[model samples]
Target: MAEQSSPDWMALARRGRRHRMIFLGTITVFLTLVSLPVVMPYLWLLTMSVTTLGSAAVMQVFWRAAGLVAVLYLALIVLPPLMPERFRTWVPAMAAAAAVILTTLFILPLTTLNNFRFLWNPDVMAAQQGRSSTIGELPSIWSAMGNSFALAGTQTALILITATPAAYALSRLAFRGRETLSRGILLLHAFPVMALTVAIFIQSYWMGLLNSILGVVLVLTTLELPFAILILKTFFDAVPWDIEMSAVTDGASRWQAFRLVVLPQVSGGLIAVGTFTFLRGWEEYVYVTTLLIDNSHMVMSLYLFWVSQDAMGADPNLIAATGVIYLLPVVALYVFAQKYLTQISFGGIKG
Candidate 1:
């Protein structure tokens, strides 16, 4: 048999495969390295809490913590690029896994202690520390949770209803000045939220919506409108008009077509947009502070702020713990909707 040489095409194929593998390996290493610095301190926080100290001691510990973080960040930047290709991918992954373990085991619980104390009123906290036997559960936090849920839910629904149609028009319609209008919508966020609150409060006062949760809802809805429209509009633009047109040819009305065809494709986007709107309003304090005057109408954000400011029998535990609890809805919402959010963005791309 005659000796055969490698063909040009086979040689090129091998070269291409090697390039891709190397590229992937490099990317994996870089991402892993970037994540290490963030994860490492969280680990340290968790670990250090095992040994104890005073207030001043804690302050010193935090300063030392900062210095350590700076060093770790520098190490990630300088050392990762210089690492061997084989080690690059696995090193970061291993580091990240270690960081995660540290965070779960040590950091979260210690950090949580601060916020947890804030939820317990003085008598209750004193009771917890064995200073007294009498105690009470966090009634205020429970009330605020209900209030936050109601307000966030209402605002989220309105955003879906109003923002969806408006966004659809902006993305799909060819109306005059649509581009300028879209830009203008986003421009509203440029002004300080406080400035906008001032203006909205003036209107609220004149209209007798001041001191009302309804008023707070109105202000948040307006503030949220820009983001809702902008995000959904982009998603709508990604959907092909061909689907709608096909439905129209079969005698489907525009509304019917949108209901049956367009919406199915954008369900993920809808969830994402709704999640964004809910989270924004859920965490918002500015408008709630300005527009609400009635204590009865106070949502959770304002309720928490009151806890922070109230002078009578204040315990850090009461505030911090409740604040953490107050954060649960946003966390839960994120957890439930994260997959939907990704899908929606993907749908937006295809739309």
Candidate 2:
């Protein structure tokens, strides 16, 4: 046979790149189509919160708002890279201010904050409807928001305090039953906490934790411990022993070395664990509803429930507004912890 000519390498490379582009474009389109059903409801919820009811001009406001947002984000993506390094830092703040100003000019008049009046005016429904209602029995939105923060915050703290040390011990120490214990921890996490709701209720009642935020915090912290410990142990295992050894050689105690050197290395895991724990407590409804009998113990989840109850007239816009408010903390936490959360590592460290 004749010697094979060199393959058309450049043509093959071009074809490969073209195929990849087509595949990626197809995937992007498919995902966007799939996501629209899930995402459009939320988009409608936001628009309903801002758009005027019964107005023909509502779509006008939405398009204007969407345009402003699109431009703002486009500027964010395109302008930053073009600026000098020194001035680039200011672009985001300036862009944000521009977006706000554009919003005020284009959309503010068309929208109403009446839906959110419950934030400051507890009797907003009564005022809007000109009638007495069961809303009077419910706590103010502020009080409910405060209770949610307290419960979630306390629960997050408890998990961190307990899980961090437990994870470190399980990761670093050579002890009897360590492997079995590690597996058991994850197994416990897999078991449904909901299955024990009745037990938890009875236990809380016996312990006088029923109807108390403190009790809810403790219960939630306990439920979150297994997963938190497992996640954190992986982070601990990823840390190199040599770093701790160097610290020890420099005369640091084992505890000090672990705290200073190892802890910093696992900061990402700690943040990820804390964020999940906090969100778990924040969104917990079954336990809160089961254990917290009194309206005084209401959380954001229950508050939203009460707002949407037929007793409250189930005003769709108001309910949507409450939903938006309910989503803020979760969104804020993700925005802040996103950097570290992306650093989360699972499984054993490579040798």
Candidate 3:
């Protein structure tokens, strides 16, 4: 029998690349179609924020810009693999540049433009003032914003302080019922937050924590703890044991080793956990509304609710303005934490 020819490894590799490219293209198209319905409303919201240039004109402009962006985005996705081998290295940089430009032109403008009417247009301000008489005294926007920041900041700090040690132990220590305990913590997260409302209220009332920022912070911290611990634990698991062992050998106490050596390695996880905790606390509504009925302790979430009730006969633009303000801090935090957040891991072995 004739000897079989050796397989063409290069041809097989080329075929694999082609298959991957086709799969990625198909996925991109599918996602784009799925996202259109979700993204259109937000696009319209941004357009409405910017120009009284009328919906028809704004929409026409939006679609044209969107089409151009889609073309560029698709080119970035589809062109790289097809490019000559010598030029392929440039594709990623070009794609990143296009992404940044697209975001700068289309996405970033929305936040700034959301409050344009209130900021720049005198007539719109006058109209808003006229409607204010019909709407009862709205809560101080500044006060509510301050309250929100205070609550979220406090909750985030508490979570980081409490989660780090607990996560380290869970990840590294060999203890009885460790797996069971970890599962139990996660099970707590599955409970509907509303289900705990009555119990929390009673506890708060008895502990003299009712209707206070501290109370809200404590409640949110409790709600956030399980997930925070879980995330931090995964990050801890990713840390190499030998590094901490070396620190211990260098006359560092266990706590010192954890603090001086281990913590720095998992900084990304800490930031990721902190960002999620802060955003949750910032956006919390039901618990805040239930616990703090008065405007004195009202947060931005409650303030937005009050505005939406037509209590101030506020225009859609004004409500959108409040939303923009409310979202800014969260956006800023995410941007600051973006690098760390991307590096967070959940799949390292216990060390």
Q: Which numbered prediction scores highest in lDDT against the true structure? A: 2
Off by over 4 Å in 2: 1-4, 7-9, 62-109, 125-136, 348-351
Q: Kindly list the per-residue Cα lDDT of model 3 for residues 1-351, writing each as its tens digit.
A: 999999999999999989988887788779888888987766566555554443455565467557656666666665765677898787778766877787677655533364555444545544554566554444467778889999999999999999889999998999999999999999987778888999999999999999899998999898889989988888888888999999999999998999899998988788888888989999998899778866678898987776655545656656666666777887799889988777765664323
Question: For candidate 3, which ten residues in a row score worst on lDDT?
Answer: 48-57
lDDT tens readout by residue for model 1, 156-243: 8988999999988887779899989988998985656766666788899999998876777778888788888877887787778898
* Per-prediction TM-score to the true structure, in the order listed: 0.66, 0.85, 0.81
Per-residue CA lDDT of candidate 2, range 43-162, in tens?
Answer: 677877865577765687767766775577456754554456898788888889998898888878788777787787767844533433545567777889999999999999999999
Q: What's the TM for model 2? A: 0.85
In order, what lDDT does every prediction score?
Answer: 0.69, 0.84, 0.78
In candidate 3, which residue pairs get closer than 3 Å at backbone N, Cα or C atoms, i.e. clash?
Answer: none
Best by TM-score: 2
Better by lDDT, candidate 3 or 2? 2
lDDT of 1 at 111: 44
